[model samples]
Target: MNFSVGPPGLIIAAPRSGAGKTTVTLGLLRALRRQGGAVQPFKCGPDYIDPAFHEIAAGRPSFNLDSWAMGEELIATLATEASAGATISIAEGVMGLFDGAAARGRSGTGATADLAALLGWPVVLVLDVAGQTETAAAVALGCARYRDDVDIAGVILNRVASQRHFSLVAPAFDRINMRIFGAILREDRLALPERHLGLVQAGEIPAIDQRLDALADIIAAAIDLDAIGQSARPAKAAIAIREAHSDGARSRLQPPGQRIALAQDRAFSFMYPHVLRQWRHAGAEIVPFSPLADDPPDATADAVWLPGGYPELHAGALASAHSFREGLQKLARRSIPIHGECGGHMVLGRGLEDADGNRHEMTGLLGLETSFAKRRLHLGYRRARLRIACALGAKGTEVLGHEFHYASTVSTSDDPLVDCWDAAGAEVPEQGARQGSTTGTFFHVIDRIAI
Candidate 1:
């Protein structure tokens, strides 16, 4: 469906990571929603985590707009689609506004600035002004003048000390003509606890609504809500996607099976929104089952999809889950194609060692050994060429994805499932494993290299 009206949209970005962009973005989403405004939230880049929080805050599903993994047209189309009926769309920027995958040979390949420039969205910059006085204003000035394409509409000073601190930074920003929307005082409660994969999943966090409401109250008291609303410039008119215009080898996104039984529990929640959406768009029925509740895949389904999530955290429960294990094994014996990624990949292995160094028995479908106890952070943007005709793609089909996990592979005796590389196309040795009808990889697919 086309957006009859081009909705007002803005990008909430920061000078760097740990600069309170997520907190401010969540706060603003809740605050705006409370004021009877329909808010659409989006996270830039190939992140599965932040969008979950965005959804919880805005009471609507959030989508990703990746400048690296996704094509420019897809990004624009997704942006328009995600905000169809919303009053305003707020996109939380990835990393620094201008910092993209510089090694990828494209300006703004993974950056928020690229997405902002593409959609002509004004940027509401969040500056974590903890210790700095006038220097914080200097940073904002530099960012505003850095790129002409990205319009830095306003600045929200986060973690300010007091009236004296705000006074010191306020004059400098005013002098440079950089609009300061609000100043948030230093508050420890505004921060969220994080794991190796960024903040713990929104579902796992207890009292999540209360936490978001507290953050919203903080923003409502400090920030200029009307100013932020007014700053969201309308996005460009929606354009017809290339897939619609041409009949070339476009991404039809066939579902792995006609009746796809998706493992959609707390343990397997990292499914990409676009692919699931595309599968439905292509006439596939998605049957969801909860592995965390010790439930099996819908027995009538043809294929099984165990997406990536925090399986390591619940390894004990999974190791003892007879219904899920026995049911999945029955499917595997019937030659049903089952695929896993990251955490799901770990669950598919022979065993997984938790952070406490306790080994838990996993489904022995693939000859792989994984351990989170001996954690090794493997984080990167990946480009994969499938070595076999596996669940991911056909032989030699290339896909753009990312690997972000704290689990280390202890052993992988089976043949490599995918010949993988970092975003720059340099070879990454022995990236994944495959057996009979089972395939597992640490890399989470964003899209099949946006042909």
Candidate 2:
């Protein structure tokens, strides 16, 4: 369906992870922007890192559009809002094109296909033609035939060894009438840096622009930018216009307060892009403070939001951030709502033990002890039912969120935060802890329930 909200858009997806989706997506985004087009970037799942690189490539803020954790209505609202004021919107898919949460939706539940069908965006599948040449076409053909809701418009061959390699791979697609865009040569430099979570955050890498530009050069030389732009189209279904209901007044997640003191630095900077955007849309004022730089939250602000980042890496510095600790302590004393997620939750504990087993003093707002030394991966979509009403919602209210952390709880208070369930609704142990007005949890809320 054609959308009047913006110009044509497309999804860069693949059969699987490590199939060069990120590289191709970034390259195409950079290549598109290099031509002086306004590009709006998006990631299909609950990832914060990829959107960072997407922003650097597109020269604008990239938002997350999750189908599993978030309701379909919320995802469409986010996509519609993100595409505003742009020539084109490009969403990089999570995992394989068909891989998504287990649900009964338009496209195999929460798969990238679901997101594509939801947004009415055609997909350009990226195939990694590493060793096999002709077999790549079979894979692309399977993806095309497997799903009816999604449109597999074209294919881009990545990691081709030579011209001969392209020749062997191109004919199979040609024979099948598949549009083959371009074959990217095998290059090690195209691989982006990685860490424990995913691709290194854009800010962590030095000269990311130069790196993206170099990638763009490689992609532009190989791919057909004009053809891609022509094939890109808006959502097939018309988007429903949503009116802002007074900065979070009718928010899914209860607004912390009218004035929120948000922690915004390298250490605590994983706030959901859409959450803050919608909060502002609701008319709430955000006051940012740098806890990593030893800055304090504004005293006048009523709520303090500590987002998750790499606080364990800077445990010593945070332990010594006099103003940050003192200011938050002051707020805690005033019974103001202080919410912490993931690493921020670690910082709100009595002590944080880094990877080396060295303990560092924390805000002591929550009577819990956590450590990175005993790291255990807890990663998945979460559905939480509030046991008690705080800032999130009234008691028994539900919210959709995701948890991705490697910190282990050493100790916790008797009072728990919320009861959680996996994506499929299996009950999880009551996770997180609450003390006074302070609430700490590893779950980073993506969206509250549609109701």
RMSD to the hidden true structure, all candidates: 2.1, 2.4
Tens digits of per-residue lDDT for model 1 on 1-451? 3433257899999999989999999999999999999999989887888999999999998888787887655666677765788999999998888888747422247888888887889999999999898998889889988989889998999999999989988999878888999999999899888887888889989999999999999999999999999999877665434445443225434577889889898889998887787678767799999888999888888888899999988899999888998889999988888889888888988999998999999988888888888767788888888887777777777777788888888887777788787867678864687888888889888777423
TM-score of 2: 0.95
Q: How much lDDT does each candidate structure score?
A: 0.84, 0.84
Best by TM-score: 2
- Per-residue error for 47 in candidate 2, Å, reads 0.3
Could you tell me the lDDT of residue 431 within candidate 2? 78
Could you tell me how far off, in angstroms, the CA of residue 354 lies in candidate 2 after the best superposition? 1.3
Q: If scored against the real structure, what TM-score would every candidate get?
A: 0.95, 0.95
- lDDT string, candidate 2, 410-451, tens digits: 888748879998877788764777888999888898777634
Pairs that collide, model 2: 1-235, 1-236, 100-111, 246-282, 247-282, 247-283, 248-282
